[model samples]
Target chain A: MRSLKKKERDKLIGDFRSGSVAALARLLSLCESESRSRRDLMSSIYPVENQPFVLGITGPAGAGKSSLINRLLFVFRKRFERIAVLAFDPTSKLTGGAFLGDRVRMAEHIKDEGVYIRSMADQGRAGGVGAGIHDTIGLLSAFGFEMVIVETVGTGQSESDVRLIADLVLVVLTPGFGDEIQAMKAGILELGDLFAVNKADQPDAERTETEIKASLALGRSQTAEAPPVFATVATQGRGVVELAGCLLEKYQELGREGVIDARRSKRVEAHVEEMLKEHCAMLVASEIKAFRTKRAKAAGRINPYRLAGALISKIFKAENNAKKD
Target chain B: MGKIRVVVAKLGLDGHDRGARVISRFLRDAGMEVIYTGIRQSPEDVCRVALHEDADLIGVSILSGAHNALVPRLIAELERSALDIPVVVGGIVPDDDIDFLRSKGVRAVFTPGTPVEEIVKTVNAIVEEKRAG
Candidate 1:
C-alpha cells in the first residue's frame, strides 16, 4: 500500500537503465502488487518501448531443455546486446507458476548491465498465461531488453501459453522417448517452429531426428516451410550454432509469411483479457475501501467486533446481491 | 555507492537446494534483498541473470562437478561485460580448487560444513569492506 516516491521511481528507472537487477526486481514487485498506485506506476512504465525478440523453448522433461538454453545463451550473447529469459515452471498441475532462474545459471554475470531475468509465479487466475505474461513481457521490453526468451515449463506441451508469448517456438526432444509415430501423437511435436533432438551424444538422437522430419512432413501446409529438426549435445556445447541459426531463419520466415502479425494480434487479445481482470480486482478493492471509509466517518452505533465478524459475509452478500439485480 | 543488490544462483543439474535457499533467506535476513534463482541453471543464463539482477555479489553454489567449466565462464562473462561483481563460489569445492578459484578473482570460495553464521558474517564483512574502501 506504499506509494512510490519520485526519488524511488527515478532510482528504479535509472537502475533498470543501468542494468540493475535489484531495482528491476523491486519495480516488478511493486508492479505485481494489487494496489491503485502500482497500477498507476505500471501505466507510466508501460508506455516506454523496446522491441525484443520473443523466443520460446519447450520440450518434455529430461530432454536437455536447460542444457540447450545454456548453449544458446552463450552463442546469443555474442550477437545480441542484451538478453532476458523467463523460464516457466509449473507451480502446480493446474496452477503452474513461472520462476526466473537466470540468476542461478549465470551467477557470475551479476555485474553485467546488459542482461535481465525474471520469474513469474502463477497466480492461478482464469485465462491462460496467468497474471498476464504478455503484459509483463511488454514491461520488460519497455524497460530496454533487446531479446526476450520465454521458456515454457518444459514438461508437457499442453501449456500452450508460451506460444502466446513468443514469436518463435523451439520444441526440443531426445532420442527414443517414443517411436516415429510419437511425434504424430501430438503434444509439442506440431507446435515447433524448429525441432531439436538434444543429447546428441545419446544413441537415440538420430532416430528422433528422422521421426521429426517424417512427422513434420505429414503436417503438410505449403504456406510455411516444414520445421527442421537438428541434433544437439547442448551440455557439451554441440549443435547450438545450428539451432540458433535455425531460430533466426524461422523468425525471418514467419515475418515474411505474415503469421508473425497474426500471432501479435492473438497476443494482444490475451493482453486485453488480463487487463480486464486487473481492472475488476481494482474496482472491487476500491469499492471495499470506500465502504470502510464511509463507515468509519459515520461510526456512531455499530460494534466493531460484530462488523468485523460479518465482513466476509457482507462482501459475499454484496456480490450476490449485485448479481441478482 | 547505493545499496549492493545480489542474485544468488545454483547452477547445473544439482538438485541440492537447501544451502542456496538458506543463503537467499539469510541475505534477505541480513538486510539485503536477495533473488534466489532456483535449481538446474546454465552458465549463460546465470550470467544473464546476474547482469539483469544488478547484483554486487554473484554468489554461486555448485554441487555438480561441472563447477570447473561453469564458474570460470561466469566470471569471464562478467569481466567481458565490464560488470565486475566480486564472485563468491560455494558448495563442494576441494582444497585443490580453492586457490584456483581465488586466483581467478573469486572473492571467497566457501565449501560444505561452513557454518551459516560464519557465512553470513563473512559476506557482510566483504560487502562492508567493498563499500568502505
Candidate 2:
C-alpha cells in the first residue's frame, strides 16, 4: 500500500474526527498494514481521553464465541450509541493469508449505523490478538465509539494476552471442554474475569459449569468472590443478557477500585516494551542476513553461540561509532 | 506493508455459494486477506462491509442470476456512501451481461471456468491499481 501524503493524512484524520466511518475504516487498514504513515496516524490519535470500554471474548475453536458476540451486540447497542467489534481469525502460517469469516455470524448488525464490525486476520501474530490491535482499538476509541469488543482468534491454553488489552476478559467454554482437573491446569482458565459455559442446552453443560466453579473456588481464597460463570445458549439468546449485565457491572466495579487505571498503565508499559523488542528483532535479523552473506565464501562449522556474541558486539560497536560521529 | 484486503460477498437470495467459497480460498492462498460475507447479503450489507473493512476491492459472487439487479444496486450503494472501492462480479453471469456489468462500474466479470490464477491475477491488478491511484 502507498503511504499517504501529509495533506491526505490530515484530511483522513479530519474526516475520522467528523464521524466518517470510511475514514475510520481506512485508518484501521493503515494500522493493520505496515504503512509508513502508521506511526503518524497513531501519534495523532494518542492519549485519547474518551477511550471506549474494551471487552475481550476468547475461547477455543467452535466454542460459539462469534455467536455469543452476535447476541451481545444487540444488548450492547441498546446501551451504547456506537459500538465496534474487532473479530479475529488466524492467518495461515503457510500462506500468510486469512479467510475472515467472523462477520458472517454477526451479519445481522451489518446495516446498523451504530454498530461497526471489523474482521481481523491474526497476520501470523501469536498470543491471540493480531498485530496493530492496540492501534486499532485506539483509533476506534478516538472515533467516538463508546464500546469496543475484541474477539480473539480461537485460542489454546497459552494465548491469554487478551487479558492485557481488554478491560474485561470473558472466557467462553462449551460442554465437555474438561472436568475440574482440566480447569485447574491453568493458562486460559486463570485469564478470565468472567466465564460462560455456552451451548448450555447440551447435556453436559451444567456439569462443565460446576467443574469451572469448583476450580475457580479452589483457586480464589484471597478475593471475596471467584469469577462468575454463566450457562448460555448463544444462538437462542438465552443467558446472554445476564452475562452482559454482569460484564458491565464488573467493569464498573473495576473502575471504582481503580483497577482499570492500573491495568491501563501496565498495558502502556507492555506496549512500549513490545515495540522496542520488535524493532531490535528487525535490526538483529537484518544483521544476521548480512553476516550470512559475508561469510558465505568461508562456510564451515562455526559455533552459533560465538557468532551470536560477535553479532552483539558488532551492533554495539556500530552504535558507539555512530554516536561518536 | 499491508496485504490487499478483499470482501467476497454473495448478494441476494442466492444460497449457491460454492463459487464464493472457492474464490475466497483462492484469494487466501494467494496471500491476501479475504473476508467472505457468506450468502444472502443485500447490496447495502455488502457496501457496509466493504466500508468497514476498508476493502480495496469487492468480488460479488451471484450464482442465482441476480447479477444485473444486485450488482448495480451494490455499485449505487457504494456510490451513495462515497466509497471508491472497485468491484468485480463472478458466477453464472451470462456473457451478454458482462459489458453491462462493467458499464455499471463492475471492474471485471468472470463466468464459470475462469481459471483461479486468472481471478487472483485480476484481483491483484485491480487492488494494485487502486492503491497506486
Candidate 3:
C-alpha cells in the first residue's frame, strides 16, 4: 500500500473533484484505512455538497439483502443515473480477512458506467458496519452519486447502527427462517423504516407477511402511517418498483418534514464520536506500549487505572501546550 | 491501523480454489481485506478488479500450470492500466521457473509447504517499505 505523495494526492483530489471514476475508487481506498492519508483525503474534501440520499439495506446473511439491493438499484437507476453501492460482509472472527461475494449477486450492473459497486469487509469495528463506512458514504455522496445504498451484513442486534447513517433503512427477512416474532425480538425490526418480506414467491410468503404485519401493528404508532411493508421476490424483481416508488415518496415526505436534516446531523455526530473514540484508544495504546518499554522496573507495581489517568492527563496537557504555542 | 486491501485471485481455467481460499483466510487473519475473485478469472478480469478495488497487492494462486502464461499477462494488464500494485504468486510453481516469474515483476512466490506466517510477514514488509518510501 503506497502512501499517496503530496503531488499525487493533489492530482487525485483534483480528478476526484472533477468526477473521475478511477480517482473516486482510489479515494475510497484511501478512506478505507485509518491513516494520515485518510485524514489528508478527508480534509481535502470536507463539508460535502450535493449530498446523496443514503438508504441502508440490512438483514441476516441468508435474507437476500444483496439480491434485494440489486433490484432496488435497477429501480433507482431509472430515476438516478449515479448510484453507488457499498456492501459489507462480516470479517472472519478467527481471521481478520473476509471474502466479499456481493459482486456475484450484483452481476447485472457490472457494465453500467452510472453504477459504482464496492464491497467492504466488516473488520469487527464497533457496529456491524465497518468504522470507515460513514466516511465512505460521504465520499460517494461528495462524488456526486444521487443515491448511495449501503448493504450491511445484518446478522442481528449490533446491525441496528445502520440507522445512524441511513435516512431510510430497509430490513429484509425471508419466510421460514424462524417465527417472525423471534426475528423481531432483536430490536433490529424496530430500526427499519420499511420492512421487506423477500422471497415472496416461496411457500411461506403470505404467512410471513401476515406475521410481519401483525408485529408491526402491535408495535408501531397508530397516528402516523405505519412503515409500509412490501412483499418482494427480489430475485424475480417482483414488487421492487413499487417498493422503490414508496421509498422515493417516503424520502420526499421526510425531506418535506425536515427529517433528512436531522438524520444527516445524527450521522455526522456518530461519525465524529466514533473517530474520536478510536483516536483516543489508539493514543492510549501507544502511550501504554511506550510506558511498558521504558518503565520495566515499575511494570508490576503500577496500577492500571493510575497509568491510564496519567496518560490521559499527559495527552490533554500536550494538546494545551500545542494550543498555546 | 488501516486495513490492507488484497486481491486474491485464481487466473485462467483453474477450477481448484482450495489454495486460494486458504491463502485468503491466511491474509485475512493477518489483518488484510482479501477480495477473492473466485476461480477461472481472466487476466483482464483480475487486473480490473485489482484496480477497481484499489488493491495494495494481488495474490495469484495458480495450480493449473498456467502461471507461465497468465501471470505475465496479468502484469501487463496492470502496467497498461498504470496500477502500481505488487503481485505475489502461490501454488505449484516449478522450482526452476521461480526466477523467471520474479523477473516478470512478481514481488514474491510461495510454493507448497511454505508457512502461511512467512507469506504474511513478507507481504507486510513489502507493503511497509512501499508506504515508507
Candidate 4:
C-alpha cells in the first residue's frame, strides 16, 4: 500500500509536465511499481503529448552498448537540451534483482540537469525490453524530453524487441567477438535500422565491418531502405558524430515517408491489446482465487480445463449483466 | 500492486560489492524492485537517485568505515532535499555506532551476518507502516 494517493500522484505528474525532474522520477517509480494507479497517472499525463524521438541501442553482451550510448549522448546533447535514457540490465533469475551499471558507464552526464538516466531491471522478460518500458517511454515523452534513448539488456537473440518500441534501432558489434558473423545471423542482424562496429581500433575491425556489410547486403529489408553500418571507436569517440547524424537523417526520412507514424500507430495498437489482455487476465485471476476459496477441495477433485471454461463463462456473464444495467 | 521500491547504494570509497549484491538479490527475491547504484557513489548522488526513483526505502552498503561521516551526511542531504524516504545502512559499522545511526534517522542497520530474510521482512514492515499512514 505504498502507493501515492490519486490526487497527489496527479499533482506530481502535473509538476513533472511542468519541468520538475523530481516529479518525473516519482512518476517513473510509480510506473515501475505495477500498481493500478500507474495506469491512472499515465492516463492523466497522456493528453500532454510531446513525442520525443526514441532511439534504441541493443546488442550482444559486452558489445559496448553503454559506452556507445555515452558517446551518443555527447553527440545528441549538442543539438538537444533535454534527453532521457532508459538502460535495462538483466535481472537475476534466482533473486530478480539487477545491477544497473550503466549509470556508472554514463557518469559523464550524471551531473547534467538536462540528462535523465534511469536503469531498469529486465525481470527475465523474453524480450530485451521489459513490460514497464513502454509506459516509461510515454511518461518521458510527456515530460517533454527532446529525445529518449533506450539501451536494452544486451541479450543476443530476443533483443529484436527494441524494434517494437524504438523509432530507430542501432545494433552494436565488436571486432573480437568469437562468433562474429555467426552471432549476427542469430536474428539480431535483421532488426538493425543501423549498425555500428564499435572498438574499431581493434585488429579485425575491417573484417568485422566487411562481414556485417555482406550480411546486410543479403538480408536488407525489401520494404524499407537498407540500413548503413558505421565504424566507431566509442571509447575514443571516433565516427560517432557521423553515426548520430546518419541515425537522425534516417529518422527524418522515415518520418517523411510516414513510416514513423505507422510504427507508432502500430505500437499504440499493441499497447492497447496488451492492456486488454492484462485486464482480462486479472479478472480471471480474481475469479480463480474466489473459486479456490469457495471450493478449496475442488482443486483436487475437478479438472482444471473444465473448471476454467465454467469460470470464464460465469465471469463474462456477470460482466455483461453489470454492463447492461 | 504497491511493489516496494528500494535503492541499494554504496557510499564513499568502499570497493567491496559482494554484500550489496547479495542484499539486492534478497530484496528482489522478496518481490521488491531494487535499483542498485554501483560502487563509489557520493551522498548527493544517492539522494538524487532516491528522489528520482521515488524509493520507499534506501539501503547503503559502506565497508570503508565512513559510517560516521558519510551516513550522517546522506541522512542530512535527504532531509535537506525534502525527500522523506527512509534510509538503511549496511556493511562494516562498529557496534558502538548502531544507536548513533538509528538516532540520526536511519531506519535500520544490517551489520555483517544479518539474515537476508530478516532484511526483507523488516523492509516490508517499514514501508507498509509508512504507506498505511
Candidate 5:
C-alpha cells in the first residue's frame, strides 16, 4: 500500500510539467482519498488555475437522460477540446447495487481521447453527490479538463445536489413522464438553468413544451439568465446540438457574471473543510485504542480535548520538521 | 512529506466496495492518512473532497463496468477543480481495459488477486517519487 501510494504520488508530481488531468483521475481512483496534503501540493505545483465549468443535467427517471447525455457529449466533443462527464446511476433497491447504465449510451466516447465520462451510483447521497464526490472532482480538475458535466439520478432529491454542484443545471422531461413535470414545479422547476423536453419525437411533444414553459413561469430561480425550454429527441439526436449550445451559453454567462469562481471557491472551501472533519474524526477513532493504552499505563488524567490538541500539534510539528529537512 | 496522505473512495453505482475498504485498512496500517469515502461518490464531489483534504492519491475501486466511463470522466472532473492528484484503479478490471485505462493516464490498475504487499510497497514508492518532484 505504501509503495503504491508512493508510486502514485511520484507519477502525479513528475507529470506536473505536462499536467495531465487523466493522471489526477487515476490517482483519486487508486487512493480513494480525501486528505489535504496532495491537494495543497497540486495547488503549489500549478498556481493560477481556474476550475472547469460545471453543468448539471437532471430530471425524472426514464427521461432519456442517458441518451441526452450521449447526444450532448457528441456536441461537446465538437466544441470542446477537453470535456468530462459524471453520470449518476440509479441505486438498486435490493442491495445498493449501482449498475453503470450510462456506458451503453456513451459507448462511442468511451474510446475518445479528449472526452472522459464517469458513472456514479446514487447510493443514498443525501446532499449533492455522496461522500467522495468532492474528492473525485478535485482529482479530475487537477487533471485538466475544461468542462465538466454531471448527470444525477432522475429524481427530485438528487436534483438538488446537481443544482448545487453545477454552474448550470438542465432539467429534462418527456411527453409521458406525467407528474414528473408537476413534481418539478415544486422545487426542481426553479433550479434548472435550462428546461429540456426530451424525446420530442414522441406524441404530445408540443403539449409537453407548453406545459414546461408554464411551469417555468411558476418557478422562480436565483438565475435570471432565462433557462430556455427546448425540445429534443435524444435517441434520434435531435435538438441535442441546440441544448448543448444553450448549456455553453449558460457557462459563459456564469463566467461573465463571476458566479463560477465564487461557487468553485466556496465549494472548494467546504469540500476541504468536510474532508478535514472526516480526517480528524477518523484520526481520533484510530488513536482511541492507543490512547487508551497510553492512558492506562499512566493513569494520568487524559482529557480528550487536550489529547487531541497535542496530537494535532505533533502532526504540524512533524510536517514542519519534514519541510525543514 | 508527512507519510504520504491517500484517500480511498468508492465511486458510482458499483457497490462491491470490499476492495476499497480492505485497501483503506492496508494503507492506514502502512502509515498513511487513508480516508475512505464510504460509498457512492460523484466525480465532482470526490474531486471536491480531494481538494479539501489535499490528498495526493485518490483510489477508486469499481467492480461495475462503468470503470471506463467513470474513470475518464473523473479525470476530467479533476481538471475542472484545478487538482492534479495521481489516480490508480482497483477491482474487477478486464485485461483489455487495462491498456485503455493507462492510455487515459491512469497510474496503474491493481487487478484482482493483487497481493496486498505489492499494493503497500508500490504506494510508498509512488508517493516518495512524486513528493520529491
Candidate 6:
C-alpha cells in the first residue's frame, strides 16, 4: 500500500470524523498494513475523548461466539445509537490468507446504518485478538461508535490477550466443556467478567453451568464476587436478552466504581509497553538480517551465542551514543 | 502492504452457493482475506458489507438466474453509497448477460467452466488496478 500524503491523510481523517464509513474502513485497512501510516493515524486519533465501551467475546472453536454476538447486537443496538463489531479469524500460517466468515452470522444487521461490522484476519498473532485490534478499536471509537464489540478468533486455553484490551470479557462455552476440574484450570476461566453456556438446549448445559459455579466457589474466597454464568441458546436467541442486560449493567457498575478508568489506564500502559517491544524487536531483526547478509561470504562458521551477545552490546552502545548526542 | 479484502456474497434467494464457497476458498488460498457473507443477501446488504469491510472488490455469486435483477441493484446501491469498489459476477451467468453485467459496472464475469486460476488472476488484477488507480 502506498503511504498517504499529508493532504490525503487530512481529508481521510476529516471524512472519518464526519461519519463517512468509507473513510473509516480505509483507515482500518491502513492500520492493518503500513506501520508508518498506522502510527500517524493513531497519533491523530488517540486524543479523541470518546472511548467506546469495548466488550470482548472469546471462547474455544465452535463455542457459538459469533452467534451470541449476533444476538447481542440486537439488544446493544437498542441502547447505543452506533455500534461496531471487530470479528477476528485466524490467518493461515502457511498461505498468509484468511477466510472471515463471522459476518455470515451477523448478516441481519448488515443493512442497519447504525451498525458497522468488519472482519479481520489475526495475521499470525498467537493471541486471541489480531495485532491490529487496538488501533482498530481506537479508529472505531474516534469514528463515534458508542460500543465496540471484539470477537476473538477461536481460542484455546492460553489465548487470554482479550482480557488486556476488553473492558468487559464474556467467555462463551458450551455443554460438556468439562467438569469442575476443567473449570479449575487456570488461564481462560479466570479471565471472564461474565460467562455464557451457549447451546443450552443440549442436555448437559445445566451441568456445565453448575460445574463452573462450583469451581468459582471453590476458587474464590467469601468476599470475591463470582462472575455470573447464563445458559443461552444463541442460535434460537434464548436467554440472550438477560445476558445482554447483565453485560450492560456490569459495564455501568464497573464505570460507577471507577474500575473502567483503572482498566483503561492499565490497558494504555500495556499497549505502550507492547509497542515499545515491537519497535525494538523490529530494529533487532533488521540488525541481525544485515549481519547475516554481510557474513554470508565468510569462511568460518559463526557462533550464534557470540553473535547475539555482540549484537546486543552494539545496540546498547548505539543507544547510549544517540542519547549522549 | 495489507492483504486485499474481498466480500464474496450470494445475492437474492439463490440457495446454490457452492460456486461462491469454492471461489472464496480459492481467493483465501491465494492470500486474500475473503469475507464470505453467506447466502440470501440483498443488494443493499452486499453494499453495506462492502462499505464496512472497505473491500477492494465485491464478488457476487448468483445461481438462481437473478443476476440481471440483483446485479444492477447492487451496482445502483454501490453508486448510492458512492463506494468505488469493483464488482465481479460468477455462477450461472449466461454468456449473453456478460456484456450486460459489465455495462452495468461489473468489473468482470465468470461462468461455470472458468478456471479457478483465471478467477484468482482476474480478482487480483482488478484489486491491483483499484489500488493503483
| Top-TM-score structure, candidate number | 6
lDDT of 6 by residue, A1-325 (tens): 5677889889998998898889999999888774766787678887768988999999888999999999999999999999999999999999998999999999888878888999999998887878867778888888898999999998658558888888999999899988777778847788889999999999989999999888767757789899999999999999999999999999999999999889888888887887888778977988979987898776378788888899989988987998799
**Cα lDDT for residue A158, model 6?**
56
User: Given candidate 3, what's the lDDT at residue A93?
Assistant: 79
Question: What TM-score would every model get versus the actual structure?
Answer: 0.63, 0.93, 0.83, 0.86, 0.59, 0.94
For model 4, how does the per-residue alpha-carbon lDDT over A151-236 read when each residue is reduced to its tens digit?
99988788877888998889998895545558455788888889999999999998888888777777557784557999999889
Error of 1 at A139 (Å): 2.8
Across A1-325, the per-residue lDDT of candidate 2 in tens digits comes to 3678899989999999898989998888888766436777778988888878999999998899999999999998889999999999999999988999999999999878899999999888788998888788889988889999999999668567798899889999999998777788958888999999999999999899999988888846685699999999999999999999999999999999999888888878877887777667876988979987788666577787898899889888987897799
Give the per-residue lDDT of model 3 (tens digit) for A1-325. 4567799889998999998777888888777777867787787788888789899988777788988888888889989989988889887877677777776577567667788888787777646688778788888888889999988876866787789999898888888656866866867678888988898899998888788777777755778566788999988999999999999998999999999999999989998998889777887788878987899788678897887788889988977898799
DockQ of each: 0.18, 0.80, 0.37, 0.40, 0.04, 0.84
Candidate 6 Cα errors over 4 Å, as ranges: A296-325
Interface RMSD of each: 8.6, 1.2, 2.9, 2.8, 12.2, 1.0
- Candidate 3 wrong stretches, greater than 4 Å: A1-9, A20-22, A35-37, A275-317, B12-16, B61-71, B90-104, B107-129
lDDT winner: 2
Q: Write the per-residue lDDT of candidate 1 for residues A2-77, one digit (tens) a residue.
A: 3667787777777767855556655665554565565556666655456678888778766777667767887788
**How much is the TM-score of the A chain of model 2?**
0.90
True contacts kept of 6: 0.87
The residue-by-residue lDDT of candidate 1 on B34-71, one tens digit each, is 66777777767676666555566778988887777788
Q: Is the docking of candidate 6 incorrect, acceptable, medium or high quality?
A: high
lDDT of 4 by residue, B1-133 (tens): 4457788998989889999988887888777778877888899988887876678899999899899899989999999988888898889889899999999999899998888888898999999887876
- Give all candidates' CA lDDT scores: 0.70, 0.89, 0.84, 0.84, 0.70, 0.89
Model 6: what is its DockQ? 0.84
